[model samples]
Target: MTTALVTGASRGIGRAIAVALSERGDRVAVHYGHDREAAEETRSLLTGDGHLVVGGDLADPAGARAVVDTALEAFGGIDVLVNNAALAPSPATLHKIDETSYEHWDQVWSQMLDLDLRAPANVSFLVARALISAGRPGAIVNVGSRGAFRGEPDFPAYGAAKAGLHAMGQSLAVALAPHGIAVTSVAPGFVGTDRQEQTLAGARGEAIRAQSPFGRVATPEEVAAAVVYLTSPQSQWASGAVLDLNGASHLRT
Candidate 1:
């Protein structure tokens, strides 16, 4: 069976992705930034044995390497690496130019880029290198965002970082192909996760749903399903692609 490492698997899309991988009989290493209890919940929700719970602050370079090393040790080898951890745009992180202070803007931008873009790049590098050394064919799927193209007025740094992530995935895809390692990314639109429930129940809910023709936001499972497919052996030829899971909300030319 394939071994998969899913970062930020404590909740939201990461949790759903871990569940999907486990359901398909893959051994999963659920990595959480914090919240050991939540990570344990994710492990318990899995269907089979061999699932592991790893925790670390991915924003730190050493922590990111330690996370990969822990998973590699537990699973022996990781066939799939899903870079799903990110500092999402919450009220606390939102830095609108007009309303936010310069210091706040700089801080938020740095934090978001560090966790969202650099962390994933570092994890991907570690995983790719391991696969290369082992001469194993593997896949790396990055969890990007539609905000990269659609724009995030209130959270510009988020959009910029995601854009960089997508670009980095493409670069790695090309670099890793000769080693039989596929790399790709998914640009998902707004997803209906538990963390977003409050916003969905609020006054702006309808407006957010109306962004897509289906009049609803994407679900975590939907994104997870796509990730499952992208990381499968059959999808090796689909590497270097940034598949859009935005439900036609925003189409790129």
Candidate 2:
């Protein structure tokens, strides 16, 4: 059975991906940043015994190593690496972006750059490097967002980070092609996850749904299905492509 590591698997899209992979008979390393109980719930939902529950702050280099090491130790080697974990900027526009107390504009940008862009790329690099050393061809799927393309003016930092991530995925696809490794970015539209439900609460979410061409937002499962297919043998030759799973509302004319 193929072994996969899925970060942020405690809930939402990550949880769905973990369950889907497990159902297909692949062992999964479910990585969660916080909320151990939620992570365990994900593990419990798995049909088989190949799922491992790993939790830690991936922003730290050591923590990142632990996430990958534990999975490798348990599953022997990783066949798939899903960089599904991310953090959005707190509710504030560029005028009020003060989450980081850096003295200069460049410094703050660097901090945001590290968290949103560098972390996933670093983690993917670690996993892909290991796979190369072990003589195994693997797949790396990054859960990006349509924001990477849309460039929300209110959330410039996030959009920039995601855009960088998409570009990095393309570069890795070419760099790892000779090794038979595939790197793909799965960009989802406004997904109706728990966070979305709470944030959009009541009439606002309803109104937004009505505006969509499909009259509803994409679900976590829909995005998970895309990730699974990209990792499957049918898409082995597909890499560096950004698969937009939006509901057609965000399409460019």
Candidate 3:
């Protein structure tokens, strides 16, 4: 059976991706940054047995290696990887250029770039090398954000990191093609995940939903559906693509 590792699977979109992978009969390695309890809960939601849970602080380069090694050790090899772990744009990460201090700006920028961009780069490299050595075709999908194109006024670092992620996926797609490893990314707009529930319930909820003609934000399942496709063997031809899941809210052109 194909085995998958979904980083940040402790909750929200990551958890949804893991569940979808499991539903398709793939064994999953659910990874969390710092929440072992939540990661275990994700394992309980999977459809099949043999699903594993791993935890590590990917911001540290060594942690990325540890995560991949743990998953590889348990599953023999990882056929799919969903880089869904990220430091999203919460109040903690907010750094609007105008109102933020230099020290806060540096802190947020460094934290976001390290975890959201650098971590994925390291993990992708490690996983790609493992796949090449084993001579197995595999898929890597990065969960990007529309903010990369639409503009994250409040979280510029988040936008920049995601933009870098998309570019990295495209570059890796070309680099890994000869080895039969496909790479792609999905740029989603505002999604209604558990982490976003408070935001969607607050005063700005109406404005956020109004951004799309559908008058609603996307669901975690919607993003998970995209991941499910991107990580499948049938989607090999779709490598190098940065599919936009913004509900037509932000069209790039």
lDDT of each prediction vs. the true structure? 0.96, 0.84, 0.95
* Positional deviation of residue 210's Cα in model 2 after best superposition, in angstroms: 3.5
Best by lDDT: 1
Please estimate how well model 2 matches the true structure, expressed as its whole-model Cα lDDT: 0.84
Q: Which ranges in model 1 have alpha carbons more than 4 Å from their true place?
A: none
| Sort by lDDT, top down from the best | 1, 3, 2
Candidates 1 and 2 compared by lDDT, better number = 1
- The alpha-carbon lDDT assigned to residue 129 of candidate 3 equals 95
**For residues 109-184, what per-residue lDDT tens digits would candidate 2 score against the true structure?**
6666666688788889889989999999899998888888887565666788888888999999999989989999
| Candidate 1: clashing pairs of residues | none
Tell me which residue pairs clash in candidate 3: none
TM-score of candidate 1 versus the correct structure, residues matched by position:
0.99
TM-score of each: 0.99, 0.91, 0.99
Q: Across residues 129-245, which tens digit of lDDT does each residue of candidate 3 receive? A: 999999999999999999999888999999999999999999999999999999999999999999888889999999999999999999999999999999888999999999999
lDDT string, candidate 1, 1-253, tens digits: 9999999999999999999999999999999997999999999999999899999999999999999999999989999999999999998998999999999999999999999999999999999999999999999999999999989999999999999999999999999999999999999999999999999999999999999999999999999999999999999999999999998999999
